[model samples]
Target: MSQDQSSVSRRNFLTGTGAALAGTAAGLVGHSLFFRPSSAGAVKQGFEWPWPYTELDPEKVRKKGHAGYYDGDCAEGALYALVSELQENVGAPYTYLPVQIMGFGGGGVAGWCTLCGALNGACAAISLTSKDFYKLSSELVAWYCETPFPSHTSNELAKNGEFLVNKSNKVFKQTVSNSPLCHVSVCKWCKENECGSGCPDRSERCARMVGDVVAKTAEILNAYHFGEFRAQCSESDLAHSCQACHSKESPYEMGGWSRGKMDCTSCHIKGHASLVDPHHPGK
Candidate 1:
């Protein structure tokens, strides 16, 4: 072809490509605008701090929690079970929640063995739905420490093939950790059951524990929603006694060195000889 004819063809191709690109960009912009909510505030209100909550069935949540454990481990499972239920029942903001955000909490946060993942997930769910997050979360930790793991209800469900997922159908032994630490909880259970932490029996035990935690969380939320929630547990007498001298408000300067409501005996002995005596100087 002649040089002039070839140049004209090249120009035409460039023009057509530019037009197509412009059209595609415009279509994308329009698509986004079309899907935008008509009233941003209306939708935003649902996501306001401490999202709205409604009563949920403990049994239903328990089943979901058990199933979620198989898929996302403890933390994700616990949070997903509650938030997914809310997503179905209440819709909107609940639907927008990324339920897997707490997945890192599994095995006490990347296997560091800190707080139990089940409790971590349930606490996040509580924070999302309740204004009294701290109080309710404390109650949850206390209940976990004091209440036996693999509640009778969960064991019965497992035995009867009623749980959503049944990795193991054995009725496992139950034990109280007397502490919320994941390492403590798992080690105690493993020691009592005579099984390794990685064993299927332990996995089943954790799954059942997730169910119990989620069910209890649902119950607490339900009670609070109905204005019937009461503090079922509180700081142990030992904790209170230790805090009297060491808490933030302690009158003695040496007494105000530590704080928190967790059981003191869980990680510390009843008494320490190394502790400084406020009454005696340099003793």
Candidate 2:
């Protein structure tokens, strides 16, 4: 063949190959975007706990005063206690023999809002550690102590009278017995404004609701021994509080420790920057 012809032919072949490769790449990219695995509910599903119990030591937990239906290092102590009780009551393979307790710095604004610490802890524990949804559900119900709340209650548990009574007189009595005086004042005001004359005892009502929720949460934790509940509760509450507090301002908006406009990572990283340092400059 002529030299010019040979050169032309070689150029054509190279161009064709390059175009084919480019087409293949484009097709792959298109397929990935259009037919990628659907993760629409990933976050919702991810928030669920995966197991019946965590793996932590019961003896050590008790020694540390971490046993009971509401005793932990901080905000979710009730969750820790519940789990400890679960270990004692449930026993055996389900108890997470050598429990692995997770840590929480403290309960944030949510605790102040009167949310039950044990419920928060239980939510955290399930979301972060459990793999089996049924087991997680069972554990949650057990922690709470009353029958599983309606939506997920099974025929068996419910038939056995495990159904939670939304307005139990017994719970009301307990609440009245345990309510703080401050709560009583708030209840009185709420009653006078919301229910003119025949307001059911407000303080007792509030106490009952709070106690029922807390007691139920503790009951669920009683079926597991690991401290996953504490860890998750602490992290979840902090995450929620941080998000709420930082949403309104920008890092530079308000001065002084209030990096009002800063994103969570930016501020939290700074706060925990010295976590590992023995002689951190800030410390």
Candidate 3:
């Protein structure tokens, strides 16, 4: 009867209704262990950032720093920024969380270049949102295998590979060459020289290659995440393997390890060396 009592009752009713709706939606959608339903409706419906809305305190945001730019601390500033933008614009929640997790875990920097970061991010998001991680991952891999990225095409040249290259020539080619460092400028040069190590134009091409790789990587990721190719590669055994290997130590660091320590080179040798296994001390 009283104004305060009426307001409290109305709030309680809304809260209860929202919870019921979320539960029903989760069940209908098939739950994923990676994604937990939130009490917040809009946030739970994949329209905003995956973080809990109620937990988004200003102090916390500030402490976390820029929503979506690359931060050296986690190499996920850009991802966070993208998620924040999605939250502001489309209100999709948890859509990018899986990507953020994988990226931060060192998956983003791996040389596979087979899947763009955006595609990987989207896949991660799906994994998080699906009810069964294994099943969903498998489905995603199957989808991606059939619908290859533009770079994956064979006759196109400039755009026919898992990773795109940019040079004055605008030509694209895919090969099993090693990826250069993450520097944008260096990547440009490598792309121009076709990943050659001794060409005179190598330096210039390398610089541009760096920029091209970063830009292309960002572009592909965005497309895969938002475009119709959402089903590409439901379960990536390669990604899964990378995740497992990197969980111990990055290949970069392992490269310089002494014989006493684990040597990635021992297993993944290139050219002739790869044909012969370096004898393990015990074996």
Task: Quote model 3's TM-score.
Answer: 0.30
Which regions in candidate 2 have their CA more than 4 angstroms from the true location? 1-75, 89-116, 132-211, 214-283
Question: Which candidate would rank higher by TM-score, 2 or 3?
Answer: 3
- After superposition, the stretches of candidate 3 with alpha carbons farther than 4 Å from their true spots are 1-102, 105-120, 142-169, 175-193, 196-283
Candidate with best TM-score: 1
Pairs of colliding residues, candidate 1: 245-255, 246-255
Kindly list the per-residue Cα lDDT of model 3 for residues 1-283, writing each as its tens digit.
2322445433344355445555444532322323445663444443322233221222222222222222321224323433443355445354434335545422235533333333344344333333233443344334433331222222232233222222223343322222211232234435644665344344222222222222333333344344432434333354344334343334644332222211233234355343543642222
Better of 1 and 3 by TM-score: 1
The TM-score of candidate 1 is 0.79
TM-score ranking, best first = 1, 3, 2
Q: Residue 175, candidate 2: how far off, in angstroms?
A: 10
Candidate 1 lDDT over residue span 1-283, tens digit each? 2323445443343355445554433322221322333453334233355677888999999999999999999999999999999999889778888988999999999999999999999999998887578788888988888999899999999999999887777888899998999999999999999999999899889999999999999999999888698989877887777677668666656666677678877887624423544343212
Model 3, C-alpha of 124: deviation from truth (Å)? 1.8
- In candidate 3, where is summed lDDT lowest over 10 consecutive residues? 60-69
Instruction: State how far residue 184 of model 1 sits from its true place (Å).
Output: 0.6
| lDDT per residue as tens, model 2, 5-31 | 445433344355445554433322221
